[model samples]
Target: MIRHIIAAIATLLALWAMVFMYQLDQKAERFRQIQEIIEKSKQEVPVQKTTQPIQQIEESSVEEQMKKEEDEVAKKLKALRERAGSAMAFKVSPLYKQKCSSCHGVNGEGAIGPSLIGKSEADLYKALTDFKSGVRKNYVMYGLLAKMSDADLKALSEEIATFEEKLKAAAE
Candidate 1:
């Protein structure tokens, strides 16, 4: 009975060893195949050809294109500035200068008030109107802007919008 038990244990150990060796061989074969593929790919050389120069546009055509672009840009800028000026001069600038400038500064750059220079006309108008109507409650500005006429408000808005343009043109 002792001899039979010893034989059985030996047989099991041999089987496990065979299985482990087979798995290692399989992994080695896979690695070898990968290396071969890499070596073969590296040996191949790509063909190179002389590239043709890109065609250039005629001088006149180029000039015309540039002119067209300039005109389009100018038109777009003018339209944008006009709209901005109209809104500033009409709705917000005067009110801001009168009521808020002592605090915010003349251009909304902020002194005692927050900067108004870049604030949109619509935003300024809405805030002022809200304050006047009690939709917004600022103790100081509310009372001040409330007394301003609609026409005055509009002119202020327009003026604020155009002020930057005037400054830029002057600088140039």
Candidate 2:
């Protein structure tokens, strides 16, 4: 009877030892997996750093594109303003269109009215003002000049200056 009891105790201890060994192996495998995950996360750090430069490049490219578009818009606006200034000076002035165009031609190469292409602002202002104030009377120009305001006269003078500059540049 004592021998049988000893044999049963030995069998239980063997089973317990086997179970503990298996659990230890499982824990070691889990630790190894966790170590592999940590290593993989470390490797991704360099990749994240590299992506920062790419993001900066993209941002700079967007800024460059916006700047290019703004430059194009500014160029177009300048061209339009230049064209309008030329038109106002040579063709679209109220006096030119209403009274002078019939004799001065569209660009002030005169048909009956004198060519006013290179006239100074002071001369033009004096003539227009005299016409307005009845100091220099003309049946045709007096009515038109009297209707123009000071702002209109100034704008016309500026347009003439712009036209002269454009002509000078073109001649050069």
Candidate 3:
């Protein structure tokens, strides 16, 4: 009976050893495959010597394209500024100068406020009335127009409506 038990234990130990060796061999094979992939990726593929000149030409062309784009953008900005009237050369009423120019700009080209240059007299008058009556919600405009009479509002609107003409005349 004792001899039988010892043989059984030895057989079980041998089986466990065999399983551990097989697992270790599988892990080593996986490690080898990963190392081969890394080596392959790190190897540099050589470029043809003739392609170097072509690459330089392409790079210079790209730089030239960028410079042309920048020049076009600058020209467009200059034209836009000229069209918008860069200088406030026209005279304005004292009432408008005092009350409107602070936020609307000297030539009504807009500063903190929206541009008032292209609006019609009627539109300007309506907007002024709306602001004064609290139909529109700008606190600054409401406060400014609140104490003004209808005549003053109308005069301001008419003057503002002519801002585009004034700018054009000044530019000429």
Candidate 4:
């Protein structure tokens, strides 16, 4: 009975090996066919006839093409400048910069934290106090404001309240 079991296990392993080899062969055959197709495509591409006389490119068309390229570059540069300008558009107090800028963006435009711009100073102060006093549930905000004084929080709120006006001025 043991001999029969051992023989059966050996037969199953041999069958599995055969199936794996067959699958591998199929994949290898497909790879070879794909390589052949790629080689044929490369060889079949029509080579431009060098025997034909080269026509002189028009100077006006060349100049026009160069102008179009320059315009595209200038447009891309302008877009990049706009993005950079918005990222650090207005200045904030050093206290806010140190405590809030990492999450709340340099201009209070919001990064990880919600936008503080356009908020009333009272609303801002309330939210900051809530975070500090454990009224709000955010661990990150609570941790950040924990060590800070009420005066600092009030100062930050006042500075944040003016972000919208500063952004408007920057836009102008």
Candidate 5:
């Protein structure tokens, strides 16, 4: 009976050892496969190459194209500034200075012409339009407004009508 029991225990131990050995071998094989994959990936990764002659030529052409674009943009901006700079400045008083200030006073305080300081925007716009259309006639004003567009007239009126506010701001 003792001999049978011992033999049974030995057999069980042998089976467990065999299973452990097989599992270890499987794990070692898995580790070997992972190492191979790592080595392959390292070889597959691309390295940055030195620029070739053709690439260098292409880069120079691209740079020239960019420079041409920049120059064109600059020219366009200069043309724009030349075209509408006065209007864009939002100070139509310069126009007044050129055409109306000698008569109207520098601040619309009334020189030879009537004071424009406290005029409403609507009134000023109507007056300017009336002047332009010859409904209100002054030879000098008529000539000054003859070629002015309605938009310019409107802008001028808006600026002139705000003179009181400008005066108050200056005082403060």
Candidate 6:
């Protein structure tokens, strides 16, 4: 019968269409898997942008950052500086500990480098300025003082000059 033959033909077409669509879907899936594999091979695992830590440097102003850098306190210190004024201002500073303690010892007594104790503020300042300006070219000192500001140089000089007093206190 023609009716039965037509029904058989329609069923065959439906089944073939479904098989074709399934093969296409599977091929698409394989391509996606291969892309992921390639990314993995390149060590570029995809991460959400929001998952990274936010850096404040891009947002903050240079002046704001400088003011925020260290705690500024009004304290008196004594030093025989070239330009000695009535008040020698001092603050609780971590710059020496952060920068010089590794080579000069924590107390400036002595270590990998010579003792910095009892050095005059003028001497310290000149030596540091020379090192920073490359007038005195020890690769290590040059590197250490290279990035220092004038304010930083003066502050460090003051702090290191007071090490003699700190030594006296420790002895007591």
Note each model's CA RMSD in angstroms: 33.3, 43.4, 34.0, 22.3, 40.6, 36.1
Q: What is the C-alpha lDDT of each candidate?
A: 0.52, 0.56, 0.70, 0.68, 0.64, 0.60
In order of lDDT, best first, we have: 3, 4, 5, 6, 2, 1
TM-score of each: 0.38, 0.40, 0.50, 0.59, 0.45, 0.46
Per residue, candidate 1 scores C-alpha lDDT tens digits across 59-136 of 445657877976886675556545333222222343444455445433444544455565567776666677677697
- After superposition, candidate 6 runs with Cα above 4 Å error: 1-92
Error of 2 at 33 (Å): 79
Question: Across residues 57-163, which tens digit of lDDT does each residue of candidate 3 receive?
Answer: 87677767877976886676556445434433577787876667656766687765788989999999999999999898766676678899999999999999999
lDDT of 5 by residue, 100-168 (tens): 555555557665578898999899989888988989965556666779999888888888988888767
Prediction 2 global C-alpha lDDT? 0.56
Distance (Å) between predicted and true CA of 92, model 1?
12
Inter-residue clash pairs, candidate 3? none
User: What's the candidate order when arranged by decreasing TM-score?
Assistant: 4, 3, 6, 5, 2, 1
What is the Cα-based lDDT of residue 41 in candidate 5? 63
Clashing pairs in 6: none
Tens-digit lDDT track of model 2 for 108-165: 5454457667878877777767877889855455545567897777666555545556
Residue lDDT tens for model 4, 1-172: 9755765664455445445434533454555465467456653233333443442244445556877976886675566555444654655677776677666666787765678889999999999999899898666676668899999989888888999999999889
**Reference-based TM-score, model 3:** 0.50
lDDT tens digits, residue span 39-97, model 6: 56654233333433453443344435544642231111112221122111222256875
Task: Tally clashes: model 5.
Answer: 0
TM-score of 1: 0.38
Ten-residue region with minimum lDDT total, candidate 3:
42-51
Evaluate residue 50 in candidate 4 and report its C-alpha lDDT on the 0 to 100 scale: 43
Error of 2 at 172 (Å): 6.4
Best by TM-score: 4
